[model samples]
Target: MTGHVRPYRSYVYAYPHKTAYRPLPEPGPALRDLWRDERKDALSLYLHIPFCEVRCGFCNLFTRIGAPDELTGRYLDALDRQATAVRDALGDTAPVRFANAAFGGGTPTFLEAAELERLCDIAEKRMGADLRAIPLSVEASPATATADRLAVLAERGTTRLSLGVQSFVDEEARAAVRPQRRADVDAALARIRDARIPVLNIDLIYGIDGQTPASWRTSLDAALAWQPEELYLYPLYVRPLTGLARRTAVTDRDWDEQRLSLYRQGRDHLLAHGYEQVSMRMFRRPGAPAQGPDDHACQTDGMIGLGCGARSYTSTLHYSFDYAVDMGHIRAIIDAYTGTEDFTRAVHGRYVDGDEARRRHLLQSLLQARGMPLADYRDRFGAEPYDDFPAELAAFAARGWLDDDAPDGLLRLSPEGLAHSDALGPELFSAEVRAAMAAYAVK
Candidate 1:
């Protein structure tokens, strides 16, 4: 930072934000060819359900509230078709294996018990992803994590179930426009435990209106009661087109300070409770059952995604269906997805060239508390990160964000670096990507 940098510039979950993606040229690369030369073994399978029971004010995820008039069934049908196409593309000519799988969305549990079974079947029969053999994870909400859904998921080998309990305090929940009582959240936790999933991840948010240090701790303790194997402490993002964006305009420094305070408090509290920091947003209990294949690395491994909201990542490209945040645009995209049939070629995506790839690898790896290994970077790119990004590394060090004491061959983030992850992560984005995002038609 030159002088004063805003801490919450943007969240860097994925490189080259979806906004950068444009329609692939006519006769875009076929899925078959896309995987023909790419590594198939140890791929990650992702199924996205774009329907949610309700949209939280702080949420900007590609999900719409409520699926009406058999919409859920239609969506699943499209997913099945897409899965079949993808499976055919990655033909058995070479090794094709799924090391891990995940069901995410508005809410995977938004479907009925039967629908949940069908969803699992699509992943298994259509895509050849052995859910039972791999680490399969699913996301749910308190209102939808019913016993029947729980039974179906457990039977199909869902190793980790992440429930979005943004806040356990009723007033704070209301402030964030995430409607749910603490009672319901508790019940959901009970159902999750009863299902015997190996890991339970509870997500909590900070910076909700009127949130205080005391209330934040209360939410943490409430979640801790379940002894969840993993905890994700998210700093609320009030992006445009979200419910909060319409109802609140909080872009002041005080809000940033408050969020930073809550974040530090939550981080220290989790550490005190024996949870290890995996990254700025992720904390895990020591020795918790690993969520996915031990060798699968997000930066290097390929991902096969199904459904409108899911984004597939090849080594050279990241692609997905039309992206939108406004409710009307989201609904229209879902409709188009359900109506489409030939799921053979990549449609909308941004190509990842070598420079972007290096940035992606470095940014994603560095955000983690464990940090990126210099040896890994050298092995992948045959060049050190410092060679590719000397100035960025220098700047991080000047700000006291880069850890000087990282073990032998690793590049790690200091506690302060981790705290300002949102700000620092975006600092690694290439200029072209920044321009694309700035000019993106967000709606």
Candidate 2:
């Protein structure tokens, strides 16, 4: 409506993309000092595993292709050291609490069963985050979702297991540069069900070359055959430095139109099948086993992240080790992370001022299908969204994207607005953040 009509610009799962972060001055704020005044009653803990069996074409996540046995060992050791440092920073007097935990990465299941056990120990024993008592979620790949690795996760009380099966069609998978067979994916899904994780989330992609509406329905029906508790429909974006970026040249109009069509088709198909939309990308069965509090939010809550790829969020700051997507740079960052000893202070991060925090809160809350409660925003910032974003809301209204029929005090997006979430998300980005992201040279 405001110019760019393409639905997908960026997937803003987190506010302020990591690229916006810069080097902190020597010896940045101590973790304890950073958390001193922040709320800790309900925090999120995340551990990142930067190893994957193979690099997919459409992937730009912070991970490497493989980790030798020794590399995995050292990586865990470094994780252990980081856990100790982080726990020390949290201090024992007040009893820090974790509401949920997740093991994510290139593929968390890449670790052996024993190593997985150790990873859990590092979280529970060292950091005092009880995986068994909390909702633990882990990501796996078709090749890495072995019985042994899955057993470790289930035994440690993983509430959800998200399998990255981008497509059920083998050729489509290959076209996406993710070489895999449909049979293997089916086998992996079977194993996940066998593990009996409370919630199973299968991720699929649309907009791949040659993916038709029929083929899209085929994949969706296949996923439904398993009665997956959750499914994420991601539009394939050939991010810079990714495998697909090298071989693919997409015209924005045609590609965007194709993606939008597939998205609507997929959305309608799922809705007809009784799955409720959670977001443009997420859909879930009505009674899926709940993973966490319905109110769990990342915008205001604090998070503790371990590993080079993970970013820890405090109320005022988000920090992590340097980020990279290039294989060479990724390997170098991982090596530095593995060899590090004293992981005491934040070295790289950005300070979140009042305006940035407000923007983050709005973007995060508004992106959900549930919309955002004006009361919540007003209570937090003492200002309404309309007061802060009149022009933006007016533009969305002009395009009929902002939902006017939402109940009083609730701000929501119309169906088309949800479709353009990717575009709208970046539209809210502060000029400073956009500038920073634009200036960041991908290493």
lDDT of 2 at 240: 85
lDDT of 2 by residue, 214-277 (tens): 9999999999999999999999898889999899996579899999999999999999999999
Model 1 alpha-carbon drift over 4 Å, by segment: 293-300
Question: Candidate 1 on 11-105: residue-level lDDT in tens?
Answer: 88788788889899987889888888888988989899998988999888999989889999999999989999999999888888898899999
Q: Candidate 2 at 352: error in angstroms?
A: 0.3
* Candidate 2 residue pairs in clash (backbone atoms < 3 Å): none
C-alpha-based local distance difference test score of model 2: 0.90
- Residue 351 local lDDT, model 2: 88
